[model samples]
Target: EEATLLLRYGQWRLRGASPDPDELQILFELAAMGGNAQACLELGLLCAKIDRQGERIFMEHGLANFKKALHWLERAGEAGVAQGWHALARIYSRSIYSQRNLQVAQHYLEKAAQAGLVEAQCELAQVCWRHRRDDPLNDVKALYWWQQAAAQGEPTAQAALDAFAAQPDAQGWALQAQALLTDKLRNSSPFLSARIELAATFGLTKPEALLIDIKAADYGHCLVVDICAHHARSKRRLIAVQTEAQRATLNRVSRLFGDVDCGFDGLEGNYRQRQYRLRTTFPDLG
Candidate 1:
């Protein structure tokens, strides 16, 4: 219902940022009775959102409610709720609370993906990438998941693509990033289609100005790809980035490993080749 409301309004404002405390209490009362897992999840997310409202909670407030929300979200996830999987994934993906329960995070995200939640599909990719030190990234797989979400006209996925394409040499992280955008161009989303044409024109000149930007971005930034442990085919490509956010966009390079350690190397021609070699390899998880 919350998702539907947000979709209907064409914005989240329809649901307001915070749920009324009095209303939340009634929902909780209903949730406590039995198969009201939905209410439990809503109440949980409400409390969680409220707890984060450091400036809104008028009086009684602490981190307790935030923690309580997690408890309820977990219960709903256990009850096989798709929303619970996504909610739990959101909690786990946050750098703030992610470190708290990684294993649980993976569990919920996978469940969500199985339940056909595109948001959870995205989260599961992250969870899979973060599972170990050297999980391979197949940009194809990344594109696959992004395609699923983007096809639904999901703004977050579109935002992810906007952020992804903004990179100077986006191809270095994943051929699929380009493919993902291209797929959007071919099938749906006219905005991305126009974006593809712009990028092609930019690539034609092979402008060196983006080099300086890429160097600066690489200093402290990492590509936050929505990749799974897939060892797919490999390819040679160049990845140029401009902003920290674009650098942080989700992407996948097929079987290329160790990209995080590569500093500013040659920029003339083989930069993309070098990047591909240094990137994390996409394992043959199949």
Candidate 2:
């Protein structure tokens, strides 16, 4: 019961509903002390994760906090949590804290994948394919790990495997792989604007529709584009544009969608008047 409560506190700390650092530290420490493996893992992740400005926390501690992350991760690993091993692998693989060792990363990834973690399998596959420092490229191992992840329904691994099958030399895949390493394609918002443009070009959505809000759905795989537009001379429509595509693969040519009712902030009052002014100002959009 104590462990459970501590775990709940740890989860609440990360919910972003609150920003009390002392509360987070208390929860994480209590949970970790109570032998909650998930808490240990989350606390380790919290410590390891770069701050909002892309800087590591506790820098003055001289990697003391990084070592603390590793300590908690090791404790979680001892508890037989596959995620702990995976997190350890990520920490080892990253250049953070002056400790980027691909071999050690691969070792932990093997442990995580053996314990049935799909993400670990995918990361292992990418690591195998990419030529990292002192780690020789191994396409055979890459294909093997990719097959493992794909069989478990990992779409990124499936896409990479398809790319490999199409071009054994992996010429076209280099750019894509590099992009993934730096997290360009992993980000979903940039694609939303492209999708919006496509919707306007095809008359699916009017070009002049005021883009009121946009957010991610399905764990950041799909975009929800919210807009306000005049559907007819007599009425204004607020629509939620749900773009559907294979996860992590949003080619400009790919098409998918759904919708929901519109809700807006600034445009909530004088809706018709604003709609008329917008339509008149952007006459070409309708």
TM-score of each: 0.40, 0.49
Which digits, one per residue and each the tens of the lDDT, describe model 2 over residues 110-212? 9988777888888776776675333423545566677778878888887866643322122322222222332342253332333333333222233222332
Q: What lDDT score is found at residue 174 in candidate 1?
A: 34
Give a tens-digit lDDT track for model 1, residues 253-283: 1112123222244332244543242232222
Model 2 ranges off by over 4 Å: 50-64, 132-137, 163-286
**Winning model by lDDT:** 2
Scored by TM-score, the top model is: 2
